[model samples]
Target chain A: MTSYIHGEIETPVGPLPRIATKWTHLDRWGALKTRWSVGRMKYRVRPGIYAVGNPDRDSRVFVTGNFKLSFDHLRRNLEGLNCWILVIDTKGINVWCAAGKGSFGTKEVVRRIRIHHLAQLVDQRKLILPQLSAPGVSAHEVRKMTGFTVVYGPVLARDIRAFLDAGLKASDEMRQVNFPLFERLKLIPVDIFYGKQYMLIVPLVFLALSGLNPQGYSFDLALNSGWKPVVNLFSGYLAGCALTPALLPWIPFRRFSIKGVVTGWFVAVPLLLAGTLGISLMEKVSWFLMMGGLSSFMAMNFTGSTTFTSLSGVQKEMKTALPAQIAMASLGLAGWIITRFIFI
Target chain B: MNRFVYLTDVVTLELDVTKCTGCRMCLVVCPHAVFGIENKRAVILNKDLCMECGACAKNCPEGAINVKSGVGCAAGIINGLLRGTEPTCDCGEGSSSCC
Candidate 1:
């Protein structure tokens, strides 16, 4: 274990814990672990002031949330620059989410400034905050309370060096948020991992229900009949969670639920056609309903991962989509029951 | 963003041009480049690009901007529905108990 105090870097304010911008073996391992587990929710640092590189009182001060990943990303990008980092306690949340939640608001920033006696340490009375943090922080209010001007920095930390070099004026490109393919792809793990519990429950319930048919409750019959429904359910999962996000921009509709339905049909139609060669028409209809509804439900969940939809917009979508999803799934279940008991 | 375009005309973002001081604060804070300064006033360059994060409205000294700002995540919304509350992102620093 690396001692937390192993290499204390000295600063004008005081000696503080230091870390390198480059990823260590431990960091790589942590990243892998976090990808699989709920570690992003738990990974955090003690919120306080820290120094990056050897710095005098004149060094710039940057503020951010205490989520270790957010902290690490910020510091790593500042490799050779001597600066001061004042971390606020957002309970391990990142800058963007924390700012929306009020944890990264005016009060916390003022409190951290006062507690750290930052005014005495830095000659400049200015704080550079992540642009995303602007929502919860009023620059005018911060100036009024702390006597320090808040300069909203670029949206991404990687642009900080250029932002500073250009006299703290961000270019148009620095302010834009880009959801490129890689960024979209990285979110897939979290989406799949978070949905795991529900994924397990849905399939098991479908399997158990498959056994309650008129023919017999034999495990062999259950396995034979249950496989198709289970496959259909998971097909929806793959369509909604995996395929939808990967092809997000290319997908047809603006609403994520609609996109999921479109993608779900793409996957479900082929599967239904392949598996229902000898099945009854009622069973086929049930499969179609289940596939569409499940896919839509799963796809609607992607609204959280997307960048464009607003809260009200999402609410509007759920208002329209949820009831239809419930009705379709319910009717599909009814059809399955009827086909097993009456048509069999 | 130019690379991706979300639902157009859906965001409830509005700007009072008369109230805008043309300080370009909205241009500075917005992650989506949703605003542009034209003729000493802020204009919606690409209204469809607005993510409704509210960074611009919060930072606007003139109070010229209005947006219903909140997290846009769906899991949070569904959780809110089940719990009888407004949907919110709690992945970090949020008040919601669920992640």
Candidate 2:
């Protein structure tokens, strides 16, 4: 909550517990640090400016969203660099998310610069911002409003030092956004956190029903209805958040939703085939319907992550897709219920 | 232009040609290259490509441009609708639950 300037710290040296710079195979330490970091940043965000190191008037100033996870990751990766952290009031949203929402935008950035009187603190009229933020903020407008030149930095803050040292030039790789395993893994918790309640509630209800009903009927009921729902939920969430982001470019299809649909199909086909091989025709049909619905619904969830689609386009999509999804889910549920009661 | 079913109506996207100063700012900033300058004036050669990122609107000095811009995602929109907020690119809606 406390905002800080550059000179507050007594030591010029940075904090301990450095983020591992070496790219290694995912291990216990990486997992531990990631989980701990995500937990610690659980929306502990207050919108204000922060100083990364003991920066003087001459040091560089970098702009970012107030999301603690984004802020922490950016600062932790700075290591020994002296810089001013100008956090815009993005309501604790990360840069990419905020940009998509227009919070990490031209108006907010300009407004923050004025509100904080950033001109007085820094001698240079330059601000290093995340390149992804370009979609939201107009560099020309920022300069016109705040008299500061907006320099789009690397996509990842971890590469800030390298970028800064290299005469404020970003390499091609730095400019490209990569959703490798670590990046994809980090996003999973956020997705889960948002959907966990819905996820847990549905399953628990089924579990309760399974316990209450007669042995064969209840067991059959739970297995028939509950298992697929739970599986679909997991499959959908993973498809949208994990698989969509991780295998972004390689997933094929230009639209993000299509990419997610492809991933969902990959998951669904295997399961459907497996179920068909082992189960009755009715069960197989139910599985097919459930899988199709789950994949489509999850694919729909991915419209937000892609570079394509407009707000109007998305609205039009929701108007069409959401109802269809609901109908599919409803039909799937009805099919499952009928099968559970009559067949089993 | 051959009408595509998915494309928003041409009338829905009104580009005030009079307000345009022919700076080509929109032409350069647009990721999709939606706008193309013919002579001095900018024209929407492919509005379908518009993701509505607001790069054109934000940089437009004369208040000449507007488009429905926001996080074009189903989850983001659903979250917005549930909150009774009109979706157009304001991420933090005074709650941690929101994006």
Candidate 3:
């Protein structure tokens, strides 16, 4: 209803807001900001009917969620096609995710069609839904309730043209959800920020604890040695939130937890070999445990962003990995603390 | 070729081929290409490839496909363990990004 909406168009549903297929600088900027978790929750478009181009009753109606990003993708893909865009209220969630949550679902689709008098506005009895929404919507049921057939579109908005050109048929690639490098990279920023609030506080606690030793506390040692743990911690975080996800496919483990540990050591071992962790064997081993444990946990949590991990598979992985990660971190932290208290 | 595959022999996705009715709804909705039509009936072609998002089960009018589907996120699982509820990314605050 802001910059995107240009004019008003009248239909059987009454005067409806019109949006363009153009992308402004602000629109692209909003996408970038949201990628980095800025103003993420509030990034929404008012859910209702939106007209893209001078659409008539015969123009195809494309449905999407209220999330502005979802709307942007759908509209941007609609380039030359004139269509009526129906934005469903999914509480600012993207279509695929909302569909998974059952918000962008059969009930909502039917509800929106009824409330907006979509049947009267469109000449055709078809609603083009994103294929991902099939998880929440029963196409047969929608047809039964709304008297309109649901034709599922491609998984990616970019493939809309191909889908439409193929007589509303989707290719195997169009239906497949991809997790390429760029997509994985784009998702890393938000995950890195997921534990960001704890970033400073956690390191500061270690810094404070660094001053302890057999001869009591020493600020000099804290300044000199504390930075090493800080580095290890940050490197572990980077490996978990960035490296593990970015190199997900290449890593040699089916379990994300183990993959995290692998990537964690891949980065941490270099620092350990450089003798930056500590001089003592206890300190060196403890850093590996802390770093690997932290990274493994963060990487495991990244199962949400992946495209192909199943619920049962993840649950199975978490069963043993979660306990192991906890024990490793706890034992490592306790060992590191004890090393400070005694000269061994 | 299987670079994208997850844990093997772990997915619960099952196909009752008798009741399939060969609608191909499962074939169309599965993001992992887990289903294929064999002899005009749906077959579980790649069972391990199933992320079990439940798209096939929900869209199947014949009720032939069944997979205990839910969010696969570890944070969602931990949250579920804490709350004693089903795995969900919809918990209040902080988890907004999870879903």
Candidate 4:
């Protein structure tokens, strides 16, 4: 009775890495995309109850939104903790976002609880939830429906151990949400990813416009023509994506768009003044229009990240500000073209 | 930090004081100091300075806070809107399709 041995698997005595091999720091587009058998993080996951730690009926249960990133962060941070992790699919969005959209609301929690047979698995009717999951989850409603008392956990998963140790209560600092420089910076990649889409289009349009000139401009002129628009495009990108985010808290403004505009203007000032020193009126107007367009356009983007803007507020801005910026850019393009053919 | 009031009157982030509790959580978390204590309750003193990160709402114990939380970038919002769903980017909302 010789049993065939499978390939020898290398082993380490120490605990395996807390994170799965797929987990990595979030890139410019949120967490980097993964190709695994589990179908990756952001996919629409099946809703169910999972165990962070196997336990009898007395183990504590934690509730989380089904957004894979949220679940991943929680599970990764939990490390050695033993508890039952209940995940309610909010259609693959994080707790905070799901809460805002109501996918993480009371009915879903109760439904998941009943569907997952949570009552039979655990003796206690307590569920620890991420603090940000409150918007859609009506505590009163969940209690009425499922009889489980909801205890709000800290904003970050790293503090969960301390919270459970302290009698299921969040410490003062645990309750506070800090948007530190690194935290704010973490969002830059997503911003850059989205911005890149627009960035790709803007320059291409300007390049075509440069070649549209009928005066048969020299190759040097055509080549140089793109240089300014390129600078303008980068300046605008920096204004909205990099500068606005990095200096967010200190930008001396309320509306993110306005703050973005101010930031763009600040960067644009030196260049604008420098470009205008000996340039013609056509160039000067074109420069001003470009600056105005880029500044406003960059600032307009600040609406989504900042605290001051509203849905209606942003819509209104897009309505009024967008046209103005586009008009300015068009004016600049028109002026540049006219200067190329009619005047210069 | 008080360089210019660029966001002045551009956006309004208001907290319904009737719903507020003096948790003092918003105080510690805000990067912009947009909130302050007034008579034991949190007030949006510098409301215009808010980045709408949903941190205060998340930390508020009473469920009394509300905010339009999403990305502050234009491209992010436009992209969200084009998808025909809510635009929350705490990695929480369903932007997983973008993944």
Candidate 5:
């Protein structure tokens, strides 16, 4: 219900809502909260027309999704500038994802433009859209449907000011998407958070399986036999989910599965050496195989977060690696069960 | 981008210079700077950098660009494998696979 009033204007969609030019502390806090929250489903705004800095008929109109973070970034970056903010109902998805899904698309843009009476509010027939939204929005179609021309702004909202100041010309740097170490590392928490259930489930299953002995269900016997398998499983999970992503570039593998296996081995070797004194050779080999497979699977999951992987490439990797991973982990688990129950 | 290169020779993006109008729409829409303008024609500058999001191909008016673009997330791929369909990034689709 928050509104900003710079000037009175009538629209086919009703009265235009107003927004502040300056972003407040609450906005920043909301952004931070949403970043850590699961799925960010609650972080969204009502979609419609909004004004910033007392925009007039000559002001530039910018289009964005109703995801609060996207909206906040767009508006906050435009502080001290007068412009028309046209938000599309994207069901809380961000511009890039929504664009891919076709929610932030030509039809929606044209509909919003007509409903908001944007042509009458702005003298210029240009609508600035986020560059990432290009996939969903066809400029030619927008122009054909509505008189407004679509001018793709910079890839990042922070560069919007510079792009606008330079007459809407984007530099090479503005166009590039940089996925730095910090950015990659920040994404780890969410990945780890989402994988938490599996993290707990896998080790607990291993522990339960390891505890079943010829002597029956004895807690002490289970604790003795199951602890190593639990540790190895957890180690593999962390190696795949956390270590592989952190050392993505330096991990010495073109494939994520390989990188994960390498990381898993890196962790497993020390544990293997430290814990091998009393355990059978089959048990040691089983731990190595299980850890390697588990880590590889976990690391492969990270392909979704990386900026370089393609859909085909991931499928290709999965085709080759997934079967190998399944074989290794399966054989290793079979070895462990045989050693604990039959050999012991 | 220079600091940490993820994978090489995986992108399917290509530019047909003969059909390119040099409108620079590819340059404008590509977040990875995969395309560059030379002699008023588009060229693939960094093919490896492409994530295949399909923005350039979608925005190209002359139909000079081609790429098999889609979300490159593994969760989406896994979901697709389970469902026996083409993988789509879960970020947009109300799925638990994405954050």
Candidate 6:
């Protein structure tokens, strides 16, 4: 029970948790932390009916995923309005992503409706679902199963009031999913931390491996040269996870891998110019390849977060790029290790 | 049109105008504005814009649109490869797959 839930309300179905329209500072803070991947999985409201303001049987029944962020958005947008919210269990995942996984889906929606006795709870046979849920929830199927006519709401939760005020009609722009710089920025933290374990393990291993050379492995040499690979790897992470997304649209090439490699080189080249890369040309090239490939791989994963990429396109790119990336990274690693052994 | 377009000519989305009943449900559900009604029938305005979400195909009453819809996520693809299943993001509790 979060602070958002004020009290309980008696309904025909049962006593349901009541949530407030305004978000407290703590609740707002939770959203920020969730964006940073803290308590992300556990951030969910109880899946069922929640009353916003005082709602009667005639009130609008809005549907949303149980993920707190999704629920918060819907409830917050419903400020000063009377409504009944039907929260579907999405395993603590947001609507769009959960819908993609089929958890915030037709079956789950129907199951919640039946278990909650929604038909008895409301007079109108309507369930206003977020438009993004359409991929998982077939309106026709919901109509057939639960006799509830599904109305797709605007893509953004903030537009919910306007959509309702406009008599459930979304303007053309309301349906569009825009990857604005701000929205892309929000996703940056999560993507950066996506491989936190790898970030740590790789660097520590590199620090130890930096001791290697033709004569013998030396701790003093490791101490002197260890920070070089660390800088390269971290730069790769930032370029792919942060810079690539920030400059996604302006970057050349449609494939995200090429885009990442471009950004990766952009970041790595600065290090080369500063003389941090290495003394040997082979070592410098190896560092560039490793950093660029690391960035390209990270940015390729970003296709998941993007709004416009098709499954076919991603699959095609992965089929070609994945092997190439593996080879590039492997060869770079081999080359770096070789530089430690033979003069280049 | 979205300024953030991806690879072109790669989407599997196919719209059969012959089966379109002019209900325009695809227009309502399509997040990318992929389908448009021309001469009282649905036509794909930009096939490349389609994310293959399958919303249009799923919501179409006439079964006029067809595409293999799934997550375009690389980690999901890798998970599918490892598990020998379709691309899924259900990597529960501390899984690397983003929500």
Q: Give the top-scoring candidate (lDDT).
A: 6
Could you tell me the interface RMSD of model 1?
2.8
Kindly list the per-residue Cα lDDT of model 4 for residues A171-249, writing each as its tens digit: 7667554556786665555555554446768777666555544567566554766666667667766776677878877
Give the better candidate number (1 or 2) by TM-score: 1
Worst 10-residue lDDT window for candidate 2 chain A reads A15-24
**Which whole-number lDDT from 0 to 100 does residue A318 have in model 4?**
71
lDDT of 1 by residue, B16-92 (tens): 99999899888888887788889989999888777788888888989999998887777787767777877766553
RMSD of 4: 7.5
Q: Model 2 - which docking category?
A: acceptable
Write down the lDDT that model 3 would get: 0.88
lDDT of each: 0.79, 0.63, 0.88, 0.62, 0.80, 0.89
Kindly indicate the candidate among 2 and 4 with the higher DockQ. 2
DockQ of 4: 0.23
Instruction: State the displacement of the C-alpha of residue B43, model 1, in Å, after optimal TM-score superposition.
Output: 2.0
Q: True interface contacts reproduced by each model, as a fraction? A: 0.68, 0.50, 0.83, 0.24, 0.67, 0.81
Minimum summed lDDT over a 10-residue window in model 5 chain A is located at: A1-10
Could you tell me how far off, in angstroms, the CA of residue B13 lies in candidate 6 after the best superposition? 0.8
List candidate 6 stretches off by more than 4 Å.
Answer: B93-97
TM-score values for chain B across all models: 0.86, 0.73, 0.90, 0.71, 0.87, 0.90
Q: What level of docking quality does candidate 6 show? A: medium
- Model 5 C-alpha lDDT per residue in residues B18-84, reported as the tens digit of each score: 9998898888887777788899899998787777888888888899888887767777787777888
Evaluate model 4: give its lDDT: 0.62
Each prediction's TM-score against the native? Answer: 0.92, 0.70, 0.97, 0.71, 0.90, 0.97
Model 3 lDDT at residue A286: 87
Give model 5's docking category.
medium
Q: Which lDDT tens digits does candidate 1 get at residues A1-344?
A: 53222367765556777656676777667667665555566777788887777766888999999877788788878888888889999888778878887889999999999988899888898899998898789887899999999998898899998999999978888877777778777777777765666777878887777776576666776677777778887887778887888988888887888888889888977886787411888888787787778778878887776656677677778888998888888998888867777554
- In the predicted model 1, the residue pairs found to clash are A304-B73, A304-B74
